[model samples]
Structures are given as structure tokens and as C-alpha cells.
Target: MAMVFADPEMLDRLAKSLDSKAGAIPQLKSRASALDAGDHVSGLPAIASWLGDTAKDLRRRANILRSPSESPFDSLAAFGLPPGVAGDPDAGKKFQTELKAILEAQKNGTPQQRAQAVKDYFATLSPAQQAALAATDPLLVGNLDGVPVNVRYAANRITIQTEYTKEAAYLATLKPTDGAYKRTQERVDTLRSFLNPRIKSYEDPKTGQDMKIEVSRQFLVFDPHFGSTADAKSSPFPDGRIAEVVGDLENADNVAFRVPGITNRLDNFNGFTNGGYQLAADPNGNERPDSAVVSWLGYDTPELGDSVDPAKAFAGGAALNAFRQGISVNLKPNAGLDIFAHSYGTLVTSKALQAGLTNVDNVTFMGSPGLGPNINSVADFKMPNTKFFAMRAPGDWVSYTQGHGKDPADFKDITRLGTDGASGHSQYYDPSTGSLANMRRIFYGGDAKPLTFTHTSLDDEQIGAAEAREMVGFLHSKVPPEIVVKMGGDLDAAVQAHFAGRTGVKDLLLEVHSVLGKYNMLDRVPPDEMFGKINDLAGNVAYKQTYKAVKDKGAPDFVAAAAGKAAELASEKLLGAVTWPVVKLLEVDRIANDAKQFGEIIDRGTAEIGGHVRELGTELGREGAQIYNDTKELSEGLFKDGGKVVLELGDTVIRPWNAGQNAADIWKIGDDAKDKIFAKVPDIAGGLNDVKNTVVDKGGDIARSAAETGGKALDKGIDIGKGVVKFFGG
Candidate 1:
């Protein structure tokens, strides 16, 4: 037994390494960006192209060892329960007669029908007998795919809970230093995941606003995923928690199953689920989208350094078994199904399809490393009627990680769709991109228009000014499915009226004050209105503060400090020139994007606002970041109290926040790298993130087309096969 835990520090390091690698890949041999030259793609000579490819390959090879995943199983004890454990020792003996009878009856039907017949057989058993089996032999009933959802949920609860109880009791008898403690802790961790799955909150990549969704731990595969072997200690990590679902799998007419890449865990499943929720959500107008999604982190995921290992995919067959079973049991006859994957996940997905993932209509890959070694093209997937689709963001670096196999985008056998959000390898699901829309159209019938340019021009190649606007708009839309879906409507009139006053006697606030005004939005609104607005915004933020003193203060000192400063910026002579246009530009935006721009314009178009403009910009960027952190701590906790459904504009609390904030800071610094090392990081790092409308993300713009028709639960494996995982929604 082992106490398996993902070291947060190690994970953070891995993300940083990959992020650096992502930056280096696009920057290979040149200080200028790839899109800087209009002739880089189509105008290039054949030799130059080959050199570029060769150079990229060399770069990937050099960095290939950058992040190999560490599997705890390698250092832990061998598989199988410890001595004297009773894991239904009588399971086989007791099931022999019933199994034989059921098989005899199941012999005549098609695989699908035979599976259903087994469900029928279980249904025929008296409730008491079924309960007895669930109590003593749940592995048999709970694991079989063809079993009814109700039966599976019931049996799994018993099997999982009973195993947990037994393990817990045993754990109590052992010392903390016991050899069994670690493994038991690992076991208990897996079991507890099933019992108390996590909630993932993220800023929607497409919209750039915070969203929340719960990752439901549906199935619990507690045994060894690699099966019996002489090198048992080196076997793949046993599949553990958890998996999340979106949509109604048992009742939905269409479903999709998603296999994840690196850094996936039961704890982080919500990030993907959030993408699915957005993907399946009803478009702004008349259509009601009906679909389901399942995000599966069902296997021991390969992390940083070991991400390219074949075992990860080779062992994916068991994860496939779970998905196949999910499809087998809950699927309505003739309903549609699709399989989706990304990066290393493509290996798992392809291997599963090649092995025998029947009835899946399409197998798709986004930012794929490649298909596994044996599989070469769409032709390699043997499932009848299965079409293959591929999408790749223009700058994504995963195309270089070929140890897993060849870039699927190069295969002529498959249909290719251009990516909207593929600014980075993992950004395919961003709502700002067309990638998610493309995939949704591919998986669900829809009309989507993905960007088809092949690097000839860099207009939409990376997240740019337009992308930022869309992201901001996505956040502030304040409408259904845009970041935080709220038809919550306008702020209360009474509340609005109460805080409607302007400040005239404000003091002289300088550099940092000017910057903080924009962060707290002091510079955006009317100079006279800055104080009242800041105080009101602070009051709203204060509502969520957990500390009684801060709560009593209404808006911590930060609010008053921010407000007081903004009031002073109104009359400050140095900034007086550009203040109006800056306010106008920012009034419509949430994030403080134009602080630096206005500062430059102030110098160029008006007076010398002095060298401190950059200083003020950096301070704005830094304060913006801190304000985000402070409020997120409050906003995230406020959900339980029903105070605020989601925080307002300029909230950068997601993983990508650092990148966003850094980008802002970089914009301010403009080339002033001598000042602070932290402020210079984004200029050195890669794109914001590998964030896609990930899981069933909305990136392809795939989801946008085809007249777009329609649109969770731990209860029934939480809609596992729907391929819809959660994103925040009411």
C-alpha cells in the first residue's frame, strides 16, 4: 500500500518546464516571432522548409527529456492486496452457476444484444439476491458494462464503500510507519475520491472568465491495471480516481468519451468538465443543445518526463473497457458516440480504438503527439463506420513529440479541421478560437468555420488584440453560457442608487496610484465617480470575505486605498492629458489592457508624463494580479454562502492568470527588463497555456455550426459516456 499524492511543487515545476519549452519551440533560432515574416510559410524555399523542420526536430529531441512523468508505482510495493485481506475470496466459486446460466442465455445475441441480455438477467434476480451480490460480490456486477446504470451505481457504492471500510479498519491497526500504510493510504485516497470528488473552477479559455464545475468520480478500478506480470513492481500505475460527466448519458441521444493527457488527476477533472459544459451549452439564441460528455482520468497518467512512454497508451485498453462498458450499458439504441483525445492522450485513444472500441462514430485528436507506433492512419482504426478527424493549433508544439507516433494532421486518410484556439498546444478549447466550434461540429452535427490558413500569415496565429477583446467580452457578456452564465440581470437599482456619489476633494495620488486606479477600475469610469464605484465594488468583494473583521469593514483597507487613490488620479496634472480617452477605452473593457498603451500615447501625443509611466504600468499589472488573488479567495468561498454567483470583470484567477498578468506587465515594461526579474518572466515564457476548450472544449469553432440544436451526476457514473464533463453553470 502506498500513500500516493501528486506533489504540487513538482507539478508546478513541470508546467513551468513545459511552458518554457513551448516558448523555445516557437522562438527556435530567431528572436523574431514566426508570424513576423509574411513569407515564412508559403514564400519559403523548399530547403528552408526542410531546415526549419529539421531544426524543429532537433529542438524537440533536445527538449524531449524535459519532462518525463514519475509513476509512484515504481517505488511502491507489488500489486494485489496485502496478506490476510478478504477481497471476496469466494467470488468465483459463488458466481460459477449463475455465470454459466447467464452466458448460456447470452450466447445467441449480437455483442450489444448479449450485453443487454445480461442486464436483463440481473433484472430478473430478486432484489434481495442482487443486494447480497452487491454486498459480497460487487466486482462482478458493478464492473460489467452491460449492467443497468442503477445497478452499477448501487453495486459500486457497496463495493467501494465496503472496501474502504475494510481498509480503514486495517489502517487503524497499523502504525503510520508501517509498510502497508502508504499503500493503504493510496487505496484510501482512491476510495475517498469516489466518495468526495473535487470541484474544478477555471477561467473559460474561450471567454476569459471564471467558471466552476464538479468532477464526479464515477468508477473505481482498485486493482492493477497492468494485470499479472513478473515485473509487477514496474507495471502501470493502477487506475485510480476520478472521472467526471456532463449531460445525461443514459437518456441523451449522443455521447462522447474523452481521454486526457498529462497532469490529469481526479482532483483536476473539473477543468475539462467545464469545457464540456460550455461545449454542450445552448448557443445564445433559440437552439437547445442536447449532448453528454465524460472526461476520464481513469489510468495512472504519465506526467512530465515519462509523458511519452508506450505503457501509458498500452495500458489504456482498461480505460477503454470502462468507456466501452459505459456505452454498452447506458446508450440508447442507435445513439451517436465519439472518442476525443489530446497530446499523449491520443495514444490512449488510438490504442483503444484499434483494439476494439466498437460503435464509435468518430475518433478525434487535438494537438496530438501522434498515433501509437503500430497504428499509421485512419485506416488503422478497424471499427465499422468510424471516421477519423484531426485538428492542430498553428503554434502547438505537440506536433514535435513523435515518440508516441506521427502527427495525425499529416495523414491524408483523415479529415482535417483548422484550429481556432490552437495558439499553443493545449489551447484548443479556448472560446476565442474556432477549434472548439470545429470539433463540436465534427462530433455533433453543426456548422463551424475553423481558420484554414496554414501559417502564410500570422493574423490569427496567436492570441492577439482581437483575441483579448473576445476574451473580455466573453467575461462581461453577463449572459447565459458566457463565462459565468447569469441572466441575473442588472445590478439592483436600490443598491446602485445607494452608492452613487462622486469625490471632489481627493488627494494627489502618483505612479502606483494611477496604475491601481485602472486595476480597481478607478481610471476607467468618470473621474468624479471613481470613489463611489471603487467603494461599491469593494463592498461587493467584501461580501465574500471570510474574516469577520474584514467583513465588518465592508471593503478592506485595500478598497479605500484604491478608491482614495483613484479619486486623486482624477486631478493629477501629469496624467490629466490622457485620462479621458483612457477612461473611455477602459469603460467598455474589464481588464486594464490600455494602461500602458495610454501611457505611451500620453508621451507620444501629449507631454512627457515622465519615465515612471512604465513604473506605473508595472504597478498596475502587479496590483491587478493581487486584487484578483484577493477576490478569488473570497469569491470561490462565497458560492456556499449564496452571496455572489461569480466575480465580475478583470478577474484573473485561473492557471493562465499568471501568464495574462505577466503579459500585462510585459506590455507595461516594453523592454525595461533591468527593473524586476518577476515582471520579465512572461516575455521569456510561452503562450498563456495549453488550455483548450479542453475536454469537450469549444475551441474548434466546431461547436458553432450546423444550426446547432440542443445542449452530471455521481448518481449514474455521472453520465460517463456523454463525453461531457462539467464547466460552471447554474
Candidate 2:
């Protein structure tokens, strides 16, 4: 009843014809652009642009036909066979026997051999017969290693829809009180979400209009019921396996697989798939998409309590290797494949790599606990040509554990990526982070070295210096034109001198202070103690620059004239005192004594500062007048009576400070912080404690009392800094 084609050569001819048409579009655009139109004529350029876009789309479609995985028969018609082959009564039996033989070969073969067997068996089937086989057993065809990617996607869609129908029918007969109702409902929701098409919307910057692009998703593997019955019965959890492809897999120039870590399941599939979408989209705003990303949740991941065991990772490795093998065989000849793994997924990826998974172009591991005990170097993996990359955000606690083995980040030959804008265990893939950008670079074969900033290296000092320069640049931009004219534009020389380090903070402070004093605007500057306190509170140069910008603008002084003076003093007293002890605490020999005491000091400081910071936050809110209510609330909740805030702050300061320390005892400080006085307080615990000790040693009871008073003052100063930052829109 259906037309059949005996020749594949016709498809090749059609593709070449389309290519010729596409090649002529630019010349046509040139001819249209050269036409001298009358004043009444318009939009010729727009028409040319449209023609250019059409050409790209035509080439893209033509390339799809040129792909090895796509055949004309796949879309147009079934392959022709002898008349007896179509209607033979024994055809079903013959198909079953062939499938059994292929399955038997796959069961005992190596991954490569299994792929070959599947490919060989499939090569024998006419397109019509293959379609019939897929329709009869969609699950088998959908998950088969050697099936064409498009055919696998179609089969899997059928399987998913069938499962959805069956589950929905079963759910209709159940009440809310039924034991299976909740699980079934969750399953239904996840399936429905997957079935729904993903649409990305954005505003056209040039046109100022909303536009939407429908992102294509293909399910390469989908299993709704994946875990053992006993495991499901023992725990109330959803267990499903999936590998979803985002973008055009068959024709993509590059493909990447994203492997998730702990606590992942079918219910949270959308979140992981969203990561795939981000990676697959063209970063350069191209009309034609060229990358495909796969979110693979193909094995049982451990729960928090069960994560200590490598049993799950080992099992996952086998499944991951098999999936990659399937992809390897199906990918276009010029396409590159990469792997992006996170947390425990890194361990799984390492295991697969060690187990002989090859042909990978790049591999990235983020927030990884460890690769494996035996994988001490890159050579431990079989992927010799693959470029290995690893990243651990400054405050990520996973690096301290080394629970599984050596950290891949510390591996000798691995490239370490920058993690700015990312922190903690789960933010590596966040859209706003440098970590994600670096990962994207690796996927697209771009160099990310320009973005790299390693913790505790000279890079830290460079970052600080760059921030200072940026502040000065901001000041230059904000200086009023009238003020610049009146001052004879000496501000540029002053800024350059500061950037060159020829003029220090104290020099700038004196200049500003003298000028304001001469104008009798001294009254406008906040008191020395308040100005110094605000400067102390500020975290970076931006806050001080905000004050300078406000001063130059001739706005209400609001302590602007004291910015440099206060900054110089704060850096001398607070930074010198706080940073020295931290430096000492990280020393290999002193970690035992100073590190323990430092933890105790932070514990005490947090307890003292927590409630006071909250009160100080409120008091500053009233004094500042223009402070944001949200900022006040943030300050109050920041310490939250000194529970987690102290540890987080300590982590922020200490991670970069001690990043170069490789001693076990230094790492043990983090381990001990999890449960002891230093618990949660990272490297900063010792520094804060040393500050307290320095105060106590210097003046005994009197100095100790002054230290507490200073703490409150510091909190007030910080609030002022926050206000200024907000005011200047820093």
C-alpha cells in the first residue's frame, strides 16, 4: 500500500541540488543590494538578510540528508524487497529468529562487538521490516545499541506514550488513599512534562519584539520502571532511567553527555534536561544550531546515606560505557563527543574511562569528591587523547573529604578551570557562573584559559588589583563634566597614578580630605570612626569607589570624602590582623595548635557577633535613612543567631587563603569543622580567633572589652558600606 524506493542515490542527488541553490543565495543578495531603488522603495536590505537566513536553513537540511545516519527511505518510503518477502506468512518467525541471534551475540560480546552485531543485523532489514519490528516491540528497538538515532527516538516516543496511557488508565481507578496513587501521580506528571515541547523565548534586541524557538528533544533511552522490585518496596522513591538528547543529534557537529550525581530521579528530569538545553543552544547567536547535549540518568544513584559505597558508581560506569558506545557508533564522522560529569558522576565517569571507554574528545568534572582510589593520574583512564578538566569552587566542601580517592582537580595533568560566581556543591552548572562558561568552551572547542583564576595563586592578587582598577575606571566615568573642567581634568592622572601604585590609598585620602577641608565641606564627611568603620565593612574596592563617585557628583557628602582615608586605615588594621593569623593557621607545622584555637575563637566570635549584627543592622537602617529594607532583613538573617553564617563567611575567606596547602592536617581542619568547634567554619576560624587572642594579649581585660566594642562598630561600618553600595548601584 506504501511506495517503496530501491535507490539511495536519488537522495544524494537531491541534497547536491539543494546545496547548489544555497550557494547561489549570496550572489542573489549582492544583486538585490546593488539595485538603485527609487525613494519609494524600501526594505531591500531586509529582503537580502531574509534570503541569507533561508540559504543557511537550506544548507542545514541538505547536510542532514548527507549524514550517514539519515536515509531518504527513513522519511519518504520503505525499502523495496522482492514480492514474496512482503507477504510471506513465515516473515514474523524469521524476524524473531534473527532478533534472537543478534541478542545472543550482544549478551556475551564486548561493547564494540555488541555494537557491530546490532549494526550488522540492522543492515539486513528493509526499512519496512524495521518499522514493523519497531512497532511490534518499541521498547527493544528504542534501546537497541545499533538502531539509527532517529529511529530509536521514534521508537522511544512510542514506548513513552504507551507507558503514559497505561499509567493514566490505572490511576483513574485509584483513590487518594490507595497505596500506589501518589507514586503513579508523580510518574504521570514526569511523563507529561517530558511529552510537552520545550519552547525558549527571548526578546529580539534589534526588533524589540518577543520571539520563541521550539527546542527539539529526543529520548534515546527511556525506562519508566527501572529499579529492582525489592529496592522499590523497601523505599518510597521513584527510580527511572533516561538519556535525553537536546538539539539535532544526527546532524550536530558536536555532542556532549551530561551525567548527574546524587539524589537524581525521573521526577527531577526537567531540571537536568534544562542543563542540556543550555549546552546545546548556540552560544554565539547563530541561526543554525550545531551542538547536541544529552542528559544521561542511566543508572541507580545512591541516596545521601548510601553514597559512601562505590557499588552504585561501579554499576553506573558499566551502563554509561554502554550508552557512550551506542552514541559513538551513531555520531557523524566529524562530530566530537564530550562528557560533563558532576559530584559522584565524576567517579562514575572515571570508572567508565578506566574500563576502556574511548574516542572521547573532552571530559570535565566539577564538584567531584574523587575519581577513584586507583586513578591517581590521567593515565589511569584509557582515553589517552581526551583533554581532562576539573573544577572545585572556592568554598566547595567536597574537596576536603577525598572520600572516594584523590581529587581529580589535584591530578597532575588535568586542567583546572575557574569557578568564579559558583560556590558550594551544586552550582557548577548554574548559568551565571564562570564554571558553566568554561564547560561551554570545552564543548565548543574554544580556549577558556583567559577566564581561568585559580585559588591561592598570584591570580588572587591579580583579581584584587583588577577590581581596584575597575573601581578607578568607574570613578573616571562618573566624574561630572563641570567638575572635570573646573579641576582641569587632573582626575585621570590621579586615577592612573593610583593604578600604577605610585600614589597609595593614603595619598588619595589626603588629597580628597585637604580639598574638602579647604572648601569647609569637612562637616559633610562622616566622623573619622564612622568613616573608618564603613570602609572596614566594605568587602571590595567597589564600595569605596561608590563613595568617591558620590563625592565627585557633588551629591550629599555622606562620608564620601573619607573613602580613601578610611580604606587605608581599615586595610592596615583589619586586614593585617585578620589575614596574618589565617596565613599562620594554614602552615603545615602550626595547623595543630593555631588551627584548633582558631576554630574555638570563631565559635566564640560568631556567638558574640550574631545577635549584635542583627541589632546593628536595624540601627544602621534608621541612621542611613535610604537603606533598603531587604538589605536590612538580609543583614539580620545573615547571621541568624550565629548558626551557619559564621561557617559560610569563614569558608569564603579561608578557601582562597589556604588553597595551596596540600597537607593532610590542613584538609583535616575542614573535616573537623563538620562536627567540632570549627565545624562549618572553614579556614577563617583560626584567623578570627587569632584576632581575639591578639587583642587579649595586647591589653588584657581592657583590650578584650575594646575588642567587643569594636565588633559592634565593625557591624555598623559594614551596614554603612552596604548602604553606599546600594545608593551608587554598585
Consecutive 10-residue window with the lowest summed lDDT within model 1: 72-81
Which pairs clash (backbone N, Cα, C closer than 3 Å) in model 2?
598-686, 673-679, 673-680
- Tell me the lDDT of candidate 1: 0.49
Per-residue CA lDDT of candidate 2, range 1-730, in tens?
0111122244445545655665665566666567843332345446555655665665554443222232222321222222223234444456656886888857877766777677778789876666655555667777877777766776666677667667667778878765556656766766655554445544577895666654434788888678532123222344778888866787888889999887677766776666776665444333225778889999887655456567789899999998887666677888989999989999999888877688789999887878877888887785677888888876566654565677787777888888878877878777667887787778877554554746443123222333433333333344533443333223434443454345798887666544433322212222332233334444455445556676778766756746655655656577656654443332222223233334445566666555455544554444343324434443444344344535545665768564344334444544544444332233334434554554444335444544865664565445445434433434
Error of 2 at 535 (Å): 33
Each model's lDDT? 0.49, 0.61
- Candidate 1 structure quality by residue, lDDT tens digits, 251-358: 776777777786554334445545565455433311123566666566666644355456767687556754575446567777688878877788888777666666
Candidate with the greatest lDDT versus the true structure = 2
How many backbone overlaps does candidate 1 show? 75
